[model samples]
Target: MPADRPYDRRRLLRDAAVGAAAVSTAGLATGVPARAAAPAPAGAPITAARARRSGAVSFRWWGTAGWRIDIGDRTVLVDPYLSRYDTGLFTGRFNPDTPLTVDAARIDPLVDRAENILVTHTHWDHFNDVPHIAVRTGARVVGTLTAYHLGLAYGLPAGRLAPVKGGEVLDFGDYTVEVVSSLHSRNGSWSLAFPGVRVSPPPRPEKISDLPEGDTLAYQIRVAGGPSVFFTGASDLNERNLTGLTPDVAMVASAATTSTADYVPRLMAALDHPKIVVPVHWDNFETPLTNPPTVAASDRERLDDLIAAVRKASPRSRVLLPEYHTAYHF
Candidate 1:
């Protein structure tokens, strides 16, 4: 079960009374707080200012699996990997023992507003920029103990690191997030296979490969009086763990391979068929953000197959393909 309500009864009652009084003063019988009011109905024309003022939830894709989610005044970043390291340079010669330089300047722009950083795993592409982003934005880092240790190794402030092994619900004033245990996408023949890093005393690795794939996590984020979004950084999912979560939006990964060919349908059913399906992590990460995103030839077939499967399994749901750095209002 989640933690008990963090508010006292008297405080709740007083807040309700104050809200009512404000509504009365504004001559509105709807009893909705001016700042907490809903935006125009779905499909209705709404400006960015109106949406923000109305406390509407918005999401901006930053290529790869990175996303900036804004719910009212709060902001949360998921699997932010904006530092597009030139992996090709390392190629067959890359080694875990070698030190890799991180360019924080490459990550600063996309993370200016992040209040919280949610990491799904410790894979390089998913976590390399996290420590720098946390340092730059003064955001709290949430992930498994492995990720926490990695943060420690990276010199991240202790006060900003939150280690959890899933099944934890966190309240951040404007929204509540539930961390659910999840599986990583299939890597070649082995399912959920990756080197596990359990460094004690925190070696403080300076190489990209030093960060191994820690426990994977999926997030179910519910914004206050707004939309709920479920995001998975990996292509695979644990259906049993996601049984009753029916988020309004599902940010599904479409690039990597999955455990089985029926992964898409199973994922949709597991999520209880979300109303909006957005395919993420489908673009090539090796390329810089300056270049228009292009679906890798190897991933194109699987991406198309996933989209087709989603359409077939959940015909009523809308498939939204988000562009790089573009904000999608929900």
Candidate 2:
């Protein structure tokens, strides 16, 4: 099992968790800190869509901690739990719905055309509607063993869903994807938080019949010419996790509650890969507040704390605090 609580791990994870003190570029700007891009070759601005597609990876946020990546001509959607389900899911547990402002509809188009869907885990908010999507879009689903099984449970064919083991890669004709591991608990169902508070309540004691909710997971995908992208669903940073891959861009969960709050420094440290850092799993829910076992106020404060820590550790990396519906090129 992972350490009961992180120790040196904490110290390392906090590399990006520097307090509000001034960061010393200290001449390392040329190193992992800042890499100057070569001058853009002058060319007529062609069709913007073609320009956008020319990028090695086209990434966009689809609410929550989910992302859409287009590698060359292959399109991959990760952890899309798009729903305006009841807010009662988060009310009293996490932070309140203080969204960073992005449209969900814009994300809908991408989902409709996704060629492949990879769920990092099985959380309702991450895997929702995915089964139907796979059926509708003819997209293959790849993820952790459990994720593949979860898709199977939703009526997906065994052939359409591939169970990925860490260190292995799945090729989609246009690109490749790899499944990674994480130390998150699924025995405990997934829950939402509202500003260090519970914005919603839990299912009735009787309705608690649904087995544990979801598990967290990580992923690595490589496109023909794009740098590899690493995505962590959520977990306490583990050294064993940094294996078999070099991430050119990494996306990790930043749910402002117990898990994210406690492990920010450590997790980020283990992911000290020099690349683009994208934040996911923030404060956003569509349901009305009315649930049990909600977030205890203490957990809500974790989000702000994690963000602060990241500011310190990764001042060198471009931090993308994405809006729900915008596209980013990597």
- Cα shift from native, residue 272, model 1 (Å): 0.7
Q: What lDDT is obtained when candidate 1 is compared to the true structure?
A: 0.67
Per-model TM-score versus the true fold: 0.79, 0.65
lDDT of 2 by residue, 1-330 (tens): 133322222211111222222123332222243222222223443332453345434676665556766554456788765554542333332222322222345345545566778776554555555776787688888766655655655667889886665666676655677766664421112232110211122231111112122444577776655567787665444556775466777776654334333465555566664466665554343421122111223334444455566667765565554444445666
Best by TM-score: 1
lDDT of each: 0.67, 0.51
The lowest-lDDT stretch of 10 consecutive residues in candidate 1 is 12-21
The TM-score between candidate 2 and the true structure equals 0.65
* Deviating ranges (above 4 Å) for candidate 1: 1-56, 89-99, 191-193, 199-201
Error of 1 at 54 (Å): 2.8
Residue 217 displacement in candidate 2 (angstroms): 2.1
Alpha-carbon shift of residue 171 in model 1 (angstroms): 1.1
**Residue 95 C-alpha lDDT in model 2:** 21
